[model samples]
Target: MQPISPIGVVRGGRRQVHEDGWGSVVSRIDLDPAVFDVSATSGLDAYSHIEVVFVFHLATRTCTGTQHPRGNTDWPLSGILAQRAPNRPNHLGVSVCGLAAVDGLTLTVHGLDAIDGSPVLDVKPYLPEFAPRGEVRGPAYAGELMRDYF
Candidate 1:
């Protein structure tokens, strides 16, 4: 497949991910004003949340095979897809965050799990109908890894 261009860049926030405070951490997704139409975000504020698809632009390398999650041996080894590791083949990340506000081509959001300067590929309003229909389940190790990732 061909690569895609970023619609915008993330800004105004802590440069690194923290173990906590994501709920209160505020950041901005600034769309490329030249290519993106501000009107595209006209009704996005109606939703309380948004799904941001971004690129892990800061990842130093790509992982095409299995590796310990977070480099913690205590967690079982698993394929890249089994964990939310940033070093994936495509280096893509999707985060659902609370929509704090929207101003023109800039969006202020809370709980976005990406670092500063991350390239935003797309932004979709969060809708109830798109949520999972059944109970969500995952491995025990996945829980352990996320215990402090928030």
Candidate 2:
């Protein structure tokens, strides 16, 4: 099997900040402008949002496998595949962030929840057809807090 190599590294100041080993951090993505110049998206300002793929660099190997999750403690533990926990076997993170603006090959995005210096895997324009539409379904109480869900 081939090992996973990061396409790019995240540049942020996120780090372990809790005694419990948990933390809150923000991240920034630095993309190579030259890479985009050859593509149709050379003028990225045309899009309003972008999808970013990054690595959970802070996730220790021990954090992988299974977890009961915060509110679902009474619902029995679930394997990583069954949940959205960051401590997965692969430790990869994907998010769709609002496009604050596009400056040359540099893009300023909003709402990327990751630590600084995380490894970036890829980035793609957010297409409406690629995104979900209409009603969303999920565990009853689990879906609460629409704003904080992400």
Candidate 3:
């Protein structure tokens, strides 16, 4: 399969997670004006959140086997798919962020997990119907690992 090009680049924030958590993080998704028209996001503001599909441009390798989550030995060993690790076969990430505002070719978002200079593959409005239908379940370690992760 062929690879896809990014539609935009992230700006302003670094890859590091904040000590205060994701609440204070903010970043801008600057789409290529040539590829995306300003009108493309005209109705986007109607939604409170947007889903951002992006690439882990900084990821070095794909982890295919089982490993501890976040290198924490306390967490049970699991395959890459079992956890939301960035080191995957495909270095892609999807984050649902609060849509702060949309300008001509830039989208101001809150709580976007990506770092500055990350490549954005696509953007979609978040609809309630698209969320999971039932209760979400996971290992107890998953909760502990994400306790500080935004």
lDDT of 1 by residue, 14-76 (tens): 697554566667899999987788898999889999999999888888998899988889988
What lDDT tens digits, residue by residue, belong to model 3 across residues 2-52?
778999999987665333376568889999987887899988989999999
Candidate 1 wrongly placed segments (more than 4 Å): 1-3, 17-20
Residue pairs clashing in model 2 are 10-118, 12-116, 12-117, 13-116, 14-116
User: Which wins on lDDT, candidate 1 or candidate 2?
Assistant: 1
lDDT of predicted model 1: 0.87
* TM-scores, all models, native as reference: 0.92, 0.72, 0.92
Between candidates 1 and 2, the one scoring higher on TM-score is 1
Most lDDT-accurate candidate: 1
Over 4 Å off, model 2? 1-4, 13-27, 33-41, 62-65, 71-76, 133-135, 145-150
C-alpha RMSD of each candidate structure in angstroms: 1.6, 4.5, 1.8
TM for candidate 1 is 0.92
> C-alpha displacement of 109 in model 2, angstroms?
0.9
lDDT of 2 by residue, 60-80 (tens): 754555676643566556677
